[model samples]
Target: MSKKGFAGFDPEGLERAAEAVRELSQSPHAQSVIQLQIRQQEAKSEEAKALQKERELKKITHDHEERRKTLQKNLEINKETADYNDKLERKRHTDKLKLQDEFQEQQRKKQEESIKREEKLKRETMEHQLKIEEKRLLIKGKVDAEMYRKNHDLHKQELLMREAERRETYKQIFQLNFNQLSLGFEYLMNNPSFMYKFFLYTASITTAFYFSRHSIQLGKNILFLRIETNLQKKLYIFLGSRYLESVIGKPSLIRETSKLSYKQFYKFPLKFYKQVTQNEQILKKNIFQNIILAPELKDNLQIISHALINKKKHQAPLRNLLFYGPPGTGKTLFAQQLAHSSGLDFAIMTGSDIAPLGSQGVHELNKVFDWANKSSNGILLFIDEADAFFRKRENWNSIEKSYGRSRYKLT
Candidate 1:
């Protein structure tokens, strides 16, 4: 009825779906419906026209009731077609609204899922951070505890060691004092009832020691028991005779004696006597002790001791060794005693003495070595903690070489 001759609410639908839909509107099936609808509409229009024509005809010639009945039927058919079109339009609108509702529901569900995912991620992140923080705190606490424990242990060990050291020091001092007292007592007891003679001998010794300490070199001359025993006996006899003269008016049997009778008598060499006495005491005091294996070593010590004491030997050993070990094992004292007993003319140096010497010190060292070499081939030169200066020379830098200096020509 319109442009394409189709009967529908939307004639444009046929053109939009397919070009052939226009032809379908002209097909026998759709055309039949269209023709019916068109016929109905045309009938209504024709019926109106007919009714008017009939009115005029009736006015001209009587008989228009049949034509009015026909007009009413055609109007009824037009109303039926209008009702069907209205139903089709309502169905299309309902379907479109249902599709829109479904889409909105899907969008809302998607948004909810997104929100849930974001919240979950936030929770997980917070939990992870909390765990890490806890672990960090735990590790820090452990480290602190371990450090405290170690420091406590170290402090305890230091306290015990200090206590032990103090006790040992007091013990050594007591032993030394005891030994000196015993020696003094034995000296008093051995003098055979000659009180004045003993007193004089003690006085001479006391005076000699006093002068020696004050460094009156000439007055400091002191003697040990190294002379013959028979000669010492005669000197004691002469002393007894003098005391008897003062007390008993010189026994008549007493006579003039040879000057040789007054030479100092020695029961045994001071070296052997002192050594035996020292060994017995050392064994009694120290639970553990060190021993040198060479019998010749003791003789060597004795020879050197006498020579130095009497100024009979001025030369010193050119080669020496310093034995190093743990504390209470006797390092310094052993060296001092060996020097004293052996009578070696020697100098002692410690690690602390290496500094303080100026740049010319190296030359002085050379002179010292040369002089010692001239002094004697047996001269011993030893420095404790020599490893400080004699480090490995791999770097070869000036500072390192200078500070860590060592001379290997120590023959």
Candidate 2:
């Protein structure tokens, strides 16, 4: 059976060619046309060969009878007879193999001969087609060699074009992301509040800051840091220098990173002290180095790097900030790390602590900044859980945390 090749026109072409031969039969070219018809049939020669093999197999097995017969023959018998029969059977099989090989060789030669014959006949057929058109118009057929070949080539080109478009789109996306990161870092330096309000995350207290300046010393920057009043809480900083090579960046190529100053690293009572640390040593040991911080600190640093060639830069302010976050996400602990990273003078004035000392504390506020001014470039004031002081007294306990959280949307 012939597999459908031109979808709907291959079998039709075979019929018309057959009709062409019939028409030739009515003319003086009948015998030669018949020979040409034989050449045209090469397309189905495989099917004919299969059928011929089936017939040959049947003839060879005819004397073998039913294959299901038992080995318990009446001649289970005479060794001499069995040996002789076995030799005869082997000889027959050898002969059959040789015949099959010869037959396949003949078919191969015949197919090649038919191909050349068709090439010659094709030229004659083209000439006939031209003659028919000269006399009268001959209707064009569905399948044409030139058109079919061109269609296949065109389909390949379309696939390649689509693949190119896909690659271009991916490249465009990568360029966009690279530009966004640049804008984000610049925006952060100019408006630290923008990052704290939007992309805020749990990080060391030492990481949250702005440009700091002392009363006398003008040019030096004093990074502000908020100190968590509670002692012994562990804080970790993450300085992720992600490379823009792929969606997952490499740390080695980072050119810069920023975090809060460590000025407050040792401030605050032991009862309120929390350890602030960033684990770069551990990450350097791993195959994939993505610097992730321990939860609790107020802000994480941004790392910019190139993976291909190693380069790095690190920066962060060691100054002031307002502590805010969800109840259990470690808002207070981060405030202390801010002072530690900056190595600055620190003070703790919570809402309640300052509430009673109000007007008198207002006077002390001047002295507080004066002392801070004389000692360090920055100061950390941890006003943790100060929502109580900010919210209405009656609403403080009865009010849902949602209302307090809404007013203080730090993250």
Candidate 3:
């Protein structure tokens, strides 16, 4: 047996079968059966193709579903990560804001403390100053009380002395003989004829006095005496014909400077004349030695002396100078020394003299200047107590004060 060949038939069988098939082919039924077999084979082939197509479609669907599930998982993971990052950022912001709030609170507290300290210090300082002022006022009050007590005691003593003197004066007046004077007064009052004669005699005497005063005044004018009063005329005549030279000499002006005497001029001429007749060098040295001045003042005096000497030598107009200070400061002495050193004539006048002259003060001052101008050597006219005239008058108005102030500068 040949392994049942391709269609499960032996060779003999196969041959036999083929013989049958040839025989059948010779018949009409055989052809019909062969055609029906071909039809059935085609149907089977179509069924197999349909089953394969169904399997391929199922596999594609399964693959697509797996890919979709993986993509959904990835999306869920990304969402969770974003949520965590947002939470972390929110926490950091919260912490930063909290820190800022705490810092501001601390700064506010410190500022309040600083303000409190400053207020306390200011209050303390004011209190201390007030205490110091109170103490000073207390001390001043004590000192004033002490001075008042001393002044009261002194005033009491002065009152007691004045009372004693008044009592003594009253006693002396009572002791004097007034009986005869009283009787004579009574008799004069009782006698009408005597009273009439007495009245006539008084009238005549009054008339004579009036006329005599006028006559004397007229005589003075005619004689060109230029004296303002009888006392002044007598004094002028007694002094000399040379109005400036006789009784008015240089050393008469000297005294204890603090207690300067208006009468010192009367005792100066012989002594001054004697000094003037001395050698020039001796006189200059004596003046320089007598003055007690500061080194700087001495230098200034030397400089002024040289200047005046040069001015006199050149015959130039002399410049006026001022020397002002408290009494006893050697202003007069300095002036005398300066005049002698500069070889200029010294003419001293007290402002007190001019003050009594009233309207004649200006005229008298002009006369002094005229006398000074006649000197061959320049004159240093020293007017002591010049403030007497230079002082502003209380009665002056604004215009007068201004005009007087300017005019006084020439003095």
Candidate 4:
């Protein structure tokens, strides 16, 4: 009973049980049952392992997908950042180019200004040098003329001194002869025939000298009168006959009353008139018929014509006119036509000519106005290129300084 208590206490029984267990394990039915149980347990274990492996695979796949998405996102972010940086860099490059262009433009403008200034300075310097050279030449010419004149005078003086010495020696010899002839002269004084012959010879010589001097003076006076008459006639022809007649009196009266010396009448720096040849094409033609003009300008011309025609009836003074336009617009032609139509003497002068005469221009202008004032008949004074000397003071340039001075002198 004690041995039966423990299943493998007896060695034989334990061996038999082991043999039976081995036989049962080797039996077809028992082997089949055991194999089925083992298969079931192996299947369960394989199923659990497959499920764990599936879970692990799903977790790894999820992690890989998440990582892929993160990497794609980072790639997209990097691409966007790179594009933004490229755009910023392009913008900076464009701005830098623009700045460089602006700086270059400014430099170019500054360089142009510098070049212009240099050119102007060079031109002014050249003009100044030329003027100085001209003055130097003029002074040198005057000095040379003075030296020549002094030498000529000294030579004449020397000749005169030699003649005087000869005359003195002759006088001394004559005085000595007269002293010797004193006694003979006393004897001849008693002879009335010799004394009468000597007196007659001296009177004849005196009369001849006086008559010769008178004839020469008369001839000179006649020549001068003829010249003055010719000059007067020329002046009358040049300056309209009406102007001379109105200002200096009738031709016949002028001739009679012109007793003043030639020097007094013919002053220096005389302003001569230029003869204007009549345009056969346009002369005596209607104002509107020959020339092309704007409608407004035509109307203005008509109005001005009417006013000028009736100007003598009205006490009001004639209105001054200013013609401003492009060159070759016939301002001068129009002025000439107006003067012709109005029966006024037209005198044309250039302002450029007056600008060179500094202070002397003032006297010249005064003379002109004075001459004009003397005309009882109206005179039309046309100043061409008026802006040469009459430019706005505020707009004066460096070259205009001399012109400005001339303008001041005129004023």
| Maximum-TM-score candidate | 3
lDDT of candidate 1 at residue 206, scale 0 to 100: 53
Evaluate model 2: give its TM-score: 0.21
Estimate, for each residue in 181-202, the C-alpha lDDT of model 3 and write its tens digit.
4665789899989989977875
Q: Write the per-residue lDDT of candidate 4 for residues 87-130, one digit (tens) a residue.
A: 99999999999999999999999999999999999999999999
What digit string (tens of lDDT, one per residue) describes model 2 on residues 159-274? 89977975775576556656765776888879978768644442343243111212112211121133542232212111111111111221121112121223332233221312
Error of model 1, residue 185, in angstroms? 6.8
Off by over 4 Å in 1: 1-195, 212-273, 276-319, 322-348, 357-382, 387-411
Q: What are the RMSD figures for all models against the true structure?
A: 35.2, 44.6, 27.2, 28.3
Best to worst by lDDT, what's the order? 4, 3, 1, 2
Find the number of clashing residue pairs for candidate 3.
0
Candidate with better lDDT, 3 vs 4: 4
Q: lDDT of each model, Cα atoms only?
A: 0.54, 0.48, 0.65, 0.66
Local lDDT at 67 for model 2: 37
> lDDT of model 4 at residue 321?
80
Candidate 3 runs further than 4 Å off: 1-277, 314-317, 393-411
